[model samples]
Every structure is written in structure tokens, then in C-alpha cells.
Target: MYETKTIKEKIKLFFIIFFPILITQVSLNLMTFFDTVMSGQAGAIDLAGVAIGSSLWVPVFTGINGILLAITPIISQLLGARSYDSLAKKVQQAIYLSMILAIIIIILGGLFINPILNMMNLESEVRFISKYYLISLGLGIIPLFIFNTLRCFMDALGQTRVSMIIILIALPINIILNYLFIFGKFGFPELGGIGAGIATSLTYWLTSILAILIIHKMKPFKEYQVFSAWVKPKTKHWKEQLKIGIPIGFAIFFETSIFAAITLLMSEYNTNTIAAHQAAMSFSSLLYMIPLSVGMALTITVGYEVGAKRLNDAKAYGYIGISGGIFIALLNGMILFLFNDYVASLYNSDPDVIALTVQFISFAIVYQLADAFGAPIQGALRGYKDVNMTLIIALVSYWGIGLPTGWLLANFTSLEPFGYWVGIIVGLSTGAGALLVRLRYVQKKYDKQQNPSVD
Candidate 1:
């Protein structure tokens, strides 16, 4: 179905898919933004607690989500190949995998909570609130994964609007709940920062439930037969997903952990610093969704081409995705560069927080451009089912290089928070360069196969 389109048509199609995912991603980030904003209202300590607690679970959940993302390409490829019969089984297996991983993450989150907090040696109030927040948020992990599984299944089948709408609806719901729970309005108890976690958990549950109902009732998904039969967990399918997914998970873990670690490292500086970092990180994360959404759509687009044995078309999609992502990043970066302080003020009113936030945002502008190159290519590689090497590259660029540089500059040198920001810029640039080179190699290899030398 996708093989005959011109590059322009394909790029258009990519954006059609990309925008809905962007909306969904934006809403998800806004959920956190609202949480942080509400927490900030409570106090700086409350804001810090939410930020710290979120750092703990963002890596865990992002990693797990990355693993489950294997399902999208898997299904997209099958759809392209017209292998309709296998779709149901693949989706069911994805659900099984998501469920298992969700349980493990929740358990591990609970087990290590105390020790990790103690080791950090945070102030008593921040530590206490952070613990409660993590525990509350942990309860929602299962639902979060379930929603992701369903979303991936729908996305692979070229149905993204439903998930976007559902999430958007949940956004207002989340805001209201946050206000009620955090401030103890509407007859709800005032739980402060922990309220943000409670609100988020409930929001996930609501959205996941809504997603399931939509999938069941929606006419478009009827042909895939996702829920037709109860299939036992197939070891072969499990390994297939893990083999493809584990590396992607680790890659995400490596990347997210560095950011999380940086947030933790900043905790020693002062409450205002950590809060400012969180504010800056939050905005950058939202901007990141633009390319990330495009990249995700690229995965589906390229996966479909490869499955249909259209290598040239896959190459075209990759080029368009990379170029489009960079263009978008450049535009967003300019906005951040021009309005760093103004943007920072949106999160908090404190002058100190705003000043540091503007500083952090300067580094963010460069990294966003760098991420534009790496993130889409990473998605393209996933579509090509070449994830293992990407994982290695992520590890080397982020932890092996980025973290050490950031640590030395921040802890040992005069740069402090600025050092960590510099390290992030370096890490993203390294990853972008490497991923671009790798994508070029893959594309060239495919080109050679499609057209041999005349000599």
C-alpha cells in the first residue's frame, strides 16, 4: 500500500502520523508539567521532591516503553508484508511482555526506594515526599504499560488519532485531579507533592481503560483481531521481542539515566538549582517530542517499506525523516535561544530559578539540534531492525563519554550545573554524528544491493 508513493507523499504521510503522536507526547509531558507546576505552588521542597521522584522512575518507565516499542515495527513490517494472520499473535505477545516488565519495574521500584533515598542523603522533607511520590506513581506502571501496548498496536496499524484523543482528554482530567488533590480542594485531602503522583497514577488508569474500550469498540481495528484468542506466551516470540527490544531499552536507559543522574547530582547544589534544572529539562523534553514523534512515525514508515521489499523507498523515508527532524529542531532551538528566560518564567516566578533555567536552556538549544539528527536516525534504524549497534553507540556516547565529562566539570571544576549541560551537548553531538554515519552506511549498503556496478 505504501510502496508507490513519492517522497513528498510519504513525508506528508509521516507528518500526518507524526502530529497525532506529537499531540499525545505533548499531553504526556504536560501531565508532568502540571505536576511540577502544582508542586511548585506547594513549595520549593515539594517541587524538588517531585523532580527527584520522577527522575527515579522516568528511566525505568522510559526503558520499558522503549522495549515495548519493538511491537510497532514488528507489526508495521508484518502489515507491509501482508502477513495479516500473525498480527493478532504478535500483539498478544506484546501485551504479555509489557505486563511482565511492568510488574518487575514496580517491584524493583518498591524494593530499592529506601536504600536509594538514604544513599542520596536528601533533606528529610524532600526524602519523605519523594518516597511517597515514587510509591504512588509506581502503582500506575502496569496501566502505563498496558496503554503503551495498545497504543503501539494501533500505531503500527496506522491508527494514532485515537490514542492522541484519549490522552488529550486525560490531560484535563489530570489537571483537575492535581488541583483537587494537591490543594485539598473539592473535598479531597491535600497531599502536596505526593498528590502529583497520585493524580498521575489515576490519570494513567483512566486513559488505559479508555484505550482498551476504544480498541474493542472501534471498527477500524476489527480486522487485526488483536483480542480474538487467548494465546499462551510463546518463547520464540518473547525472545524475538526481547532481542530487538532489550537493546533499545538499554539505549533509552543509558540516555535517560544520564539526565536522571544529572538531576540527582544537582540536588547537592541547592533547592533552587534542582528546581531550575527540572524546569529547563521539562521544557526541553516537550520540544524533544517534535522530532521524537517524527522519528516514531519514521519507524513505522521505514519498517513498512523494508517489509514490502522496497529498499529505495525506505532510504527515501530515512532521508526525509532526518531532514525534517533537523528542520523542526532548528526552529524550536531558535525559539529557545531567543526566549530562554521568558520560557523559564512559565514554570516558576523565582528569579534565581529563572536565571539558572535560562542558562540550562542555552545548552538545551544545541542538544535539541543534535538530538534531531540522532533520534530520527535511531528510529530509522529500529525500522531497519538494527538496534543492537545503536545501543552500543548510546552507551558510549552517553555514559562512557557524557557522564564522566559532566561529572568532572560539575563536581570538580567551576562549571557546576553548566558543566553538566556542556556534557549533555557533547554527548548528543557524539551520538548524532555516529548515528548519521551508521544510517549512511546502511542506506549505502541497501543502494548497492538494489543497483550493482555495470563493470
Candidate 2:
């Protein structure tokens, strides 16, 4: 039944599948935004506390998220080839691999949360708040990892709607939980920032439960050998997943670590500045969902085409995805540019916060085109299972150029936060240029190997 799609139907299916995933991604971010807004309303200290704690946790989760990126591509390729038996074992393997990684991340997150808080030299209130927030949040990291596996499994099987639906269902529950805990509404103890963390932890597990139910009920992945093989985990299958996923883990970790590191630096400043930075970044981040989700779709499409031995179709999808991202970036940048102050003000009512938000977000908007342009390039590379250069690119763009440049701009120069953002643009642009060139070169080389001659 899945094999009956026409070319046009396939493209439409791609977009339809992708659009909901985009919304799911955006909704996930909204969960964070609401959590932040709730904390901010409690107090400036609460806002900054959660922000700092989040900075420490974000890199870890992002790296894990990256590590899991190999899933949809591998599964989709196998699914496309109708290799159901291999697909079943691989699914089990992904879960096993995720479980192992999740444990390490959870321990690391729990162990370091307090130390990182202390290192920030935050106000006594801010430090305590951060510690409380991180403790509860850390417990949910493992569930978050498990949820990641479910999400990819659903998407690869063309059940993207399952993840989307689960996330959507979880959001309202999260909001109600946050409201009850943070404000002590409905007979619950008022927990404030800590309440936000608890609410987040609950929602993480809740969403995973929802995904698990959906995956089980669906025909596509209902027979997954791994899901049924809950008795004894297959060590060989686990290694197979790690073989594909470990590089992804490193790539994601390296990339997210850069942003997290930057946020850590931002936390060292005044609380007001950190709050403002989060507000600015929060808005810029929401807009990124479009290209990022599109990139995800590109991965699935390319993987399927290659597995099906339709390389020309893979190349076509690559072009489509990259062009699509450029258009999205241009449109998103224009809107952000036009409504800088308006968007900034939406997050916080403070005039000072709003004003600073506009400045930073404006600078960020400048390089968004270049930033978005890189999504498909990296997506295509991941599609081809060619991430060996990911570490090099990440190091050069994020650490080698991005972090140092941002520091000089923020500290030594007059640009301050504005310069810090300019550095992000430069890094993204540089990475995009190099990755795109690499994609082109690889595609040509692969085509030549298959064709033997251009003529």
C-alpha cells in the first residue's frame, strides 16, 4: 500500500508528512517558551534561573537528539526497500542504543547541574532556583531519549502524524500541570520554577506514553521485533544501531555544545541580560522549525531514494529541500526584521527586555538566510551517511570561528550582544558554504561511480 504512490504523490506526501513534523517541532519549543514565560512571571530570578539551568541541559539533550538522528534515515531506507525483518531488528537496536546513551546523559546532567549553577556565580536566589529546576528536569532526560526513539520510528514508517498528535496532546496537559504547580492552583502546592521543572518532567513521560500507545496501535510498526523483544535485548542489533548512530551523536553533541557553551557564557553576565538573551533566542529559535523539519524530510526522502536505487530522485529531493529552505529563511527573516520589537515584546513586557531583544534578534535575523541555507546541505550529507566531516565542520564553524568571535564581539568590542549575534551569522554562513560545496562534490562523485561518464 505504501508503495503505490506516484512521483507527484510522493512529493505531496513528503510535504504533508513534513508539515506536521514542523508543527510538532514548533510545539515542542512552545512548551519551553510557555515554561519560561511562566517562570518569568513568577520573578526575574526565576526566569534567569531556569534559563541558566536550561543552558546546561540543552547541549546534552541536543547531542543525544543528534545521536539519534541516524534512526529515521536508516529505518526509512530499510522500510523503503521492504526489508521488514531487518527493519524490526534495527528498531530494537535503536531503542537499545538510545537507552545506553540516555543513561550516561542523565547521570552527566544530574551530576553537573549543581556545579554549573555554582559556576554561574548567580545570585543566591537564582542559584537555588536553578538547582531546584535542574534536579527535576534531569530525571526526565531518559524518558526524553526514549521518546526520541519512538518519534523517529513513527516518522520513518510514514506515521509522522503519530508524533505530531502525541506532542499536541501533551502540550495542553503540560500547560495545566505547569499552571497548577507553579501557582499552586487546584489544591497543588505552589512550586514556582521548581514546579515548572516537575511539570516538564511529567509531560516528558506522558508524551512518551502517548507515542508508545500510538506506535503500538498503528499497523506500520506494530510488529516491530524490538518492541516485542522486550525480554532480552539483542546485543548485535544494538551494535548495528550504534554503528550508524554514534557518529550522529558526536556531530549533534559538537554542534549543540557550541550553542550551549555560548549560553553558558551569556549566563555569566547580569540576570537581566541573560533573560533578554533567552527572550531574543527564543523567538529566533521558533522560526527555525521550518527549515529544520524540512531538513528532516530531506533525510527521509534521500535515504529512501538511495535504498530504492533512485539516485536521480535523491538528487532532485536534495535540490528541492535546499531551495525550499532558502525561501523559508528569506520569508522568516523578512518577518523577523519587520517585527523585531513586536516579537520581542511578546515574550516579556519589560521595556528594557523588549528593547534589548530587538537588537539581538535583529542581528540574528541578518544571517538567517545563510543559516537556513545550510540545513538541507547537512541534511543531504546525513542522508548519504557521510558525516565523517561533521566534527571538523562543527569545530571550525561553532568553536573555531563562532564562540571566539562571539566573545570578542560581546566583550572586547562595542558591539556587545549585537556582535555576538554577528558571529553566529558568520559561523552559519561559513558552515553552509562549505557543506553545500561538499554535498555537490559528493553527489557528482556518486553519480560518476554509477554512470562511468557524464556523456
Predicted model with the maximum TM-score: 1
Q: Summarize candidate 1's per-residue lDDT along 268-313 as a digit string, tens digits.
A: 7888888889888888988988888888988988999988879888
Model 1 accuracy (lDDT, Cα): 0.88
Q: How many pairs of residues collide in each model?
A: 0, 1
Model 2: per-residue Cα lDDT over 52-107, one tens digit each: 77766666777678778788888878866778777666666677777888788767
Model 1 poorest ten-residue lDDT run: 446-455
C-alpha lDDT of residue 434 in model 1? 92
Task: Give TM-scores for every candidate, taking all chains together and pairing residue i with residue i.
Answer: 0.97, 0.94
- TM-score for predicted model 2 compared with the true structure: 0.94
Runs of candidate 2 with Cα error greater than 4 angstroms are 1-10, 223-226, 229-231
